[model samples]
Target: MTAKTLFEKIWDAHVVAAESTDTPAILYVDLHLVHEVTSPQAFTELRERGLKLRRPERMLATLDHSTPTLPTAANGERPYANDEAKAQVAQLESNCREFGVALHGWDSADRGIVHVIGPELGVTQPGMTIVCGDSHTSTHGAFGALAFGIGTTEVGHVMATQCLLQRRPKTLAIHVDGQLPQGVGAKDLILHIIGQIGVDGGTGHVIEYRGPAIAALSMEQRMTVCNMSIEAGARAGLIAPDETTFAWLQGRPQAPQGAAWDAAVARWRRLPTDAGARFDREVRIDATAVKPTVTYGTHPGMAIAMDAPVPPARNAQEKRALEYMQSQPGQPMQGMPVDVVFIGSCTNSRLSDLREAANVLRGRRVASRVRMLVVPGSEAVRRDAEREGLHQVFTAAGAEWRVPGCSMCIAMNGDLAQPGQLVVSTSNRNFEGRQGKGARTVLASPATAAASAVAGSIADPRDYLVEVAA
Candidate 1:
């Protein structure tokens, strides 16, 4: 066989049928994750067509987008305050029960963000095609799975067939060199990449994030890197599964058992880009050059150094972004007052992320002027954090430690920063109105978010870490 890129290898492995180069190929899905917001329409379509799910066992459903961070009742059973939000959650429950598909509702110990639970449950694995009705589905690629988001119609298509007709995406390889400097993390690394490539630089491509720096990151960190691939306009992003990947999966609930696991590992080892493999485009970045980064504009690409002044608006978009953020060009955001700090999202809400943030907040307190939230990504994450005393650290620091869900990352629910307020978040997108109406959001790492919560501004984590160290 000819040498092939990792993306080609994974895509080909799942191709059930193909006719011509121009037509979409039938790619079998190994995992189908659904959520309340998008899956409702897909399920309704299935019902209207009088179609039963082809494979209920292959599908998983969860409630996150509309679940409230503040539970309305004890025992973690909370109905969304908004009737529409409550209906979405209730509809998903009814659909899953009727379809015989398993659901990880807010009541489930396994519940949280769809992307967060997949890997934790041992369901997300290498050499598999995974699809979700949410854009951040690219997050699963950290396990070496070929995962991406699908629309409502496509969601219905997969439910009935467990297959998708997809045209092959061009491959782009991004290589990183050396070690990341202290205080720099996967969030900073990806934000820098977006800034360099521009928002559309990755259009029509499936990005393979490779090289030493990528290989060095833990599975959680790798997930953070892959989570934002869509922000770069790529269909998905993946890393070849290795020891770090295998170690994280070995004992998860859905992982292959014993001998089956060994065989899976052997195949995953060979799935890396073959020597002399070709790519449509390539980018290289030095890990040392990355710094603690934060977005100053509405888009993820409009980022500058955490302590530096917002760059002079170079385009109309940046100009408008500056106006929305209510900041002047060339003014440092370091001491700029922050009204809120959000330190959770699929992008950086994993245990490692929480640990890093907790490390910064251990002996410190949230600034009196700022409202801070440290939401876990999943129920399992929340439970583990509580056991590890992470929850106490966050709460003791004057931050609200909330239940797991996609809280404040999107304003689908009511967990949003107030209009016109400046929010420093650990979520992926920082677009205008993403957090709430007229809300200005700056994206950063969990540690950065924690630091800003302490300083009441967009403070740098390195300085705070040093303070804690001292």
Candidate 2:
């Protein structure tokens, strides 16, 4: 038997019909995640063709991208200000029911960002193939799954056949050796990786994150790292499942139970890459050297250390990004006044992310000049945080506590950073007009966002972390 990379192994397992190794292959999809923003058109396509879903049980639908972060009205409808937004969410509910697929619709306790709830519900598992219309669907790859995003037409294809035609991608191994220093997190690590490899570094590859530091991350932390794979131009990012993965999946509602659970664990334990597995490309980073990172310019690739000065532009695109951000070379990101602080996204809205931010926020108040918002990723995350009084901690610290949704991650759904305002955000993208038109968005970790909210400027989280004696 030949040693195979995890990506090849998983891809080979799902190959249903293929003309050649390089040509299109019909691949079986084990899980299909859907959201209202992209599913409406796909649903229309399915309806136009008079096609019924091939596997309704494997399809999970949620209203996320177009959902309102504020509480829904008494009638249980999302309080979307725009008629189009309201109708899009309604269309999803109608479509899911029409197709006999289970939906975690708006205001449902299971309702949340599709990516966040998939793992929380145990629908995402190791060695499975998952797809979503949303780009961040690569998130599920953290569980050793082969997950990727598809287009609306592809969404319709998956809906009609529960399979997708794919060309296998080359593999890249991102090795993060050593232990992370204090205040450096999965968010910082991934940002550093993106900065080192550039936005298009992994363009033709599916990346496998290896080495001791990646192995040390909690399941949620690993999800945070893998969630941003698309930002680096990778098809997907994967972390081999281990004891941590099994521990997180054990008792969840959709997870296997009893003897089946044990069997699943035993099988998952073998999904890691073999000792001699080869990859097409490899990059190594010393995790101990990674600092608390922040994106100074438009793209996620233009990241710098929290305290380091922004380097001179390397090209026209770099120069343009700095101009759009109104930032000059040789200036550090710290001390720049922030108008808003947003702490919610599939990238960093897990309970662990929230708890870290709340720890920095206790007894501290946001700057009077800044508007701060913390939206949980899921109802389950919100419920867990409230049970621990994290909501009170946020509210008392002068930040708004809102419902779970993909709020402020994009400029959509009425939750937006006002034009000309500078926002320190936990959301992934900082592309031009991503948060809102003419909005200057700076991306950082949740802890960093919380600290900056209180400081009213781009601030380092380490300055705010309370040292606990070991």
Candidate 3:
């Protein structure tokens, strides 16, 4: 038998029909996660075609992109961003009910971001193929699952038949060599990778992150890294399953139990790449060389170390990004005034991320001119943080404690930055107007966002880490 890469192992196992040069392969989908933003149209397609869902038991739904992060009003209303947002939520509810799919609706304590709750409930596992209508679905690949985003048409197709036609993507091996320096994390490491490879570096490839540095990260941190693979133009990202993966999944609500758990682990242990498995391409980085990084332009790839100045634009597109960001070549990102700071997103909204931010803001206060928001990725995360007094740490530091929702990350949930305001955000994307019309977004990690909130500038998290230690 030929040695197989982790990706090939999973892909081959899930292939219902093999791929040919002219046609795509028919692949089985293990899980289909649904959300309000993208599923309504897909559901409409299904209804129009009179197609009953093929596997309702394999589907999970949630309302996040359009749900309000602020608390309900005195009237017990949800405070939806708009009537359309409310309608989208309602339609999803209707669709899920009609299709007999389980939904984590507003009344459910489990309600949260689709990506966040999937793993929280242990539904995401090794060697499974998962798809969602959202691009950040790559986050699920952290569990060694073959996960990727699908379009509305694909969503409908998957609902009608629990399979998808997929063209094979070349595998790219990203090897991180050394331990990350203090104050730098998975978010910074991914940003550095995008900087090195450019935005389209992983086009037509599924990246497999491996190395001692990757092995050193916690499960949540690995998820954080995988979540942003879409921003690099990758079809998906994966990390081989290990003891760390099993430990995180063990005893979770939906995880296998007793002998089943033991058997699952035994099978998962075989999912990693074989010794001689070959990748289409490989890139290596020294994790120690990566610094706490931030994006200054309109794309995730336009990033630099927090201590460095903006680099000269290499092309017309880069120049346009700099102009839109109100920055000139050689302008320093550090100490640049920011009007807002956001410390939550699927990219970095887990308990570990909140704790990292809280450690920076524990004894500090947000700058008087800065507006800071700390939104959890899920209800469970919110409850856990409250139990740990993380919410109090944020609020006491002058940041608003928001409920679980996509919130400002999508800027469609009424939490948005004002025009021309510079926002240091922990969200994955930094595209212009992503947070709001004319809002300048600087993507950073949660700790970096917290530091920037307190400093009212694009400050280095290492400085705050020193203060936190002191």
Candidate 4:
């Protein structure tokens, strides 16, 4: 028998029907994640067609995007961005009730950003096929799941029949050797990867991040890496299940228990790519060379080491990105003034991420000229951070500690950057107007974001880390 890649193994198992050159394969979906913003339209389609969800138990819904990160008013009314946002939430509740789907409502302690809550609840597991309307759904791929985002129409299709028609994406293996320097982490690693390969380099492929460096990363760090695979144009990102993966899922609310867990781990252990399995393509990176990195332009690919000068654009599109960002080819990023610093998103809002940022902010103060917001990824993360007194650190440092939600990541919520402001954000994308109209976004890791908040500029996180250690 031929050795099979991890993706091939999962894809083959979930295929209800094989694909041909001109036809797509019918693949079974193990989980469907729903959020208020994109799910209403999909549910509407289901209602119009008189269709009920085929597998309600396999779905989990939450309210995120467009939900204000701020708490309710004194009158106890949620300060939704607008009536449409409020309506979307209500519509989701109605649809979930009508379809018999489970929803983590605002009052639920489990409610959070869809991607964050999925793994937190242990609903995302190895070898499972997961889909959601939001692109960052690939975050679940950190656990070896075959996860990807879908469109509203496809969401409706999955609701009607717990299956999807998909063409298998070719596999791209990214191998990283050596150790990442202190203060540089998963977010920087991914940004560096995107910089090396253009934003579209992973087009038409699924990326499997492997090697010693990848294996050394924690589960949350791996999630941060996979969460941005979409920005690389990959259908999904995956890491084979290992001891670390199993350990993270062992006792979660939805994870299997007792003998069942043993059996599940046994199964997952077999899911890694078979030795000598061939990939369609491969890219190798020396992790030692990676540094605290940040995006200087309007896209994820236009990034450089935090200590390095911005590179010159090679094309018209590149020039436009620089112009939009108000950046020049030889400009130094280190001391560029930052108007705001936001550290939260599915990509890097986990507890560990908050702790890392807090480490940099402890006994420090946000610059008088800079405003900073730190939003947790979920209710659980918020609770955990408060328990650890991380929130106190943030607030003491003069940063706003926000409620759990997508927050400024989507910019549709009440949390947004003012026009013409320069933002150092921990979110995945730095696209034009992503945070607000005329806002310039610089993508960085949590540590870097916190450091920038202190320095009022794009500063190296290592400076703060060294001080913290001392």
Steric collisions counted per model: 0, 0, 0, 0
Rank all candidate structures by their lDDT, best first, as comma-separated numbers. Answer: 3, 4, 2, 1
lDDT of 3 by residue, 1-470 (tens): 99999999999998899989888999999999999888888888888988899999999999999999999999999899899999889999988988899999999999999999999999999999999999999999999998999999999989999999999999999999989998789999999999999899999999999999999999999999999999999999999999899999999999999999999999999999999999999999999999999998999999999888899988998889998898767877988899999988889899999999999899899999999999999999999999999999999999999989998999998999999999999999999899999999999999899989989888888898896577
Query: Judged by lDDT relative to the true structure, which candidate is superior, 1 or 2?
Result: 2
Stretch of 10 with least lDDT, candidate 4: 326-335
Those runs of model 3 whose alpha carbons end farther than 4 Å from true positions after fitting are: none
lDDT of 1 by residue, 1-470 (tens): 89998888898888899838677899999999999988888888889999999999999899889988886677655657588888888999999999999999856899999999999999999988999988899999998888999999999999999999999899989999888998789999999889888888889999999999999999999999999999999999999998899999999999999899899899889998899999999999889999999888899888777767788888787789899988777787777789999988999898999999999999898999999988899989988999999999999999999988899999777899888999999999989999998899999999889999999988889998887777
Model 4: runs farther than 4 Å from truth?
Answer: none
Question: How does model 2 score by TM-score?
Answer: 0.98
TM-score of 3: 0.99
Q: Tens digits of per-residue lDDT for model 4 on 295-400?
A: 9998898889977888988899888998888887887788889999999999989999999999999999999999999999999999999999999999999999
**CA-RMSD of model 3:** 0.8
Clash pairs (backbone) in predicted model 1: none
C-alpha positional error of residue 284 in candidate 2 after TM-score superposition, expressed in Å: 0.3
Clashing pairs in 2: none
Reference-based TM-score of each model:
0.98, 0.98, 0.99, 0.99
Q: What is the lDDT of residue 415 in candidate 3?
A: 96
